[model samples]
Target: MKHGVTVALLVVAAMAGTMASARAQGGRIEERALPYTPLPADIQALDEVIKAPLTDDFVAKSFTAPDGRIVPYRLLTPATATVQLAQARLPLVIVLHGSGSIGQNNVSQMTAFAKAWALPALRQRFPAYVVAPQVDVRSADYAPGGDGLLASHPGASLPAILALVDDLLGRLPVDPARVYVVGFSMGASAALDALVAQPGRFAAAVAFSAVPPDRDRAVAVAGTPTMQVHGDQDTENPFDPDHAWAEAVAAAGGAPIFVRYQGMEHRVPPDMILAPGWREWLFAQRLKSAAPFPNP
Candidate 1:
């Protein structure tokens, strides 16, 4: 009887030890999966090259989003002479393209920004880590009005964009405080959706020719600094709601700057992206006091 009791006690102790070990292992795995954590060495090197000097040679790569969907993106590193000699952990800009380029090859969307505005400007003065993620809308359903699906799904395009940011952060040294987002047309709606889904994640967001979402939970993004640019002649998305969006953002205690261009249309003009004072305006704005919108 004494031997049986001792054996029983020993078994209980062993089982408890096993359980503790299992819990510890689980916690480690969870931490490893977190988004903002530093990535492995190989990924870090690749990120550095992406932000390095541009010598008439550009590289494009593809990464898998958290939802297991492949997203193609382009990275243009400024030439060594162009890069700021003192700055480390370069600033990042994530660009979202319009609906016309949605189902097309990622190169079309990438070149639109990379070759158009980002690379040219960076080659002259500022060198930034630019990311253009192509959203594959072939598999996802869209509302009749061309907006995102009303029902939420795991692998939707908007979520895929967010996941792209997570993947980039894990693989690169991105400045959390200086991350910026720019979207056009359908992409503008996606930008607004992203801001609504995750508040305070971006330093600044610029949306051009955009329509406000049907139902935006303002409380989610009360702290994000945003810029709305609309052409007065735009008919597809219109400019009236752009004004309304700015008002709603202000009411939510956020500083939303709205720009209405004269004689502009639904297209994103080069002047809009290359405006002399635009970057200054974007950099000067700061994210301040973000409180939830009062319930009506």
Candidate 2:
């Protein structure tokens, strides 16, 4: 009886040790596999839209204006549009790429910025309609000797962009109030120009490492909610211009949110889009009305 009792105790201890080892192995497996999971569903859907197959019909559509200038644009719709539209018309976000991205192959610029902003990833958090308009210098006519003529022609880019927006709105269900615009570098400057030319066309504007338009132009859209993000160490475009513009906008009765990243350069930070606090701050603003109090 004593021998039987001792064997039973040994077997129980051995079983417990085996179970603990199994649990540890399982945990390690989970840790290793979790990172590979595709981003949230909405993000996955957006990424798929970015990577979706394209052809002349699906992309690179060209339109000729009455002035004989040709404008080309690309439009990306959510992959799960049937379901996403059911909830409500998804918000539209117009992404403008920087100067380096200008040319016949403008799609490259939009693709790069969309990926950098993690537009696909953000889709999981917020469903949006993304429109990318490419400004081709080869086709559009510019006034002679204008300083940064390409940069100044918001009319050149704005019409193509707005036409695309209007086309999308006519074809797809979209929420007018949630329309947003985001631009980087040269495109950022163009976004500002757009707001000035057509006041209140967008609900919000986000500019990164951009040169603010002329003060007179900026003041026209002073009431529009705008967010300016720049790195303190940005050499391409000095930080002072952005700071000065933010001050000017605020002085004109617009509350501009200025985010300065210390020890950073011209590139977008890895987690800027996903930062919980920033997201709350972005969604909280009312573009049509007065700006909210400074973020605490």
Per-model TM values vs. the true structure: 0.68, 0.65
Q: 148, model 2: CA deviation in Å?
A: 16
lDDT of 2 at 64: 57
- TM accuracy, model 1: 0.68
Cα lDDT of candidate 2 equals 0.54
lDDT of 2 at 279: 41
Worst 10 residues of 2 by lDDT: 27-36
> What is candidate 1's lDDT per residue for 136-201, written digit by digit as tens?
772222242223313211226777778777666656655566677878877776777777666776
Count of backbone collisions within predicted model 1: 4
Over 143-186, each residue of candidate 2 has an lDDT whose tens digit, in order, gives 32222322233546556666665555555556666677777777
Stretches of candidate 2 above 4 Å error? 1-68, 81-85, 116-121, 138-156, 273-296
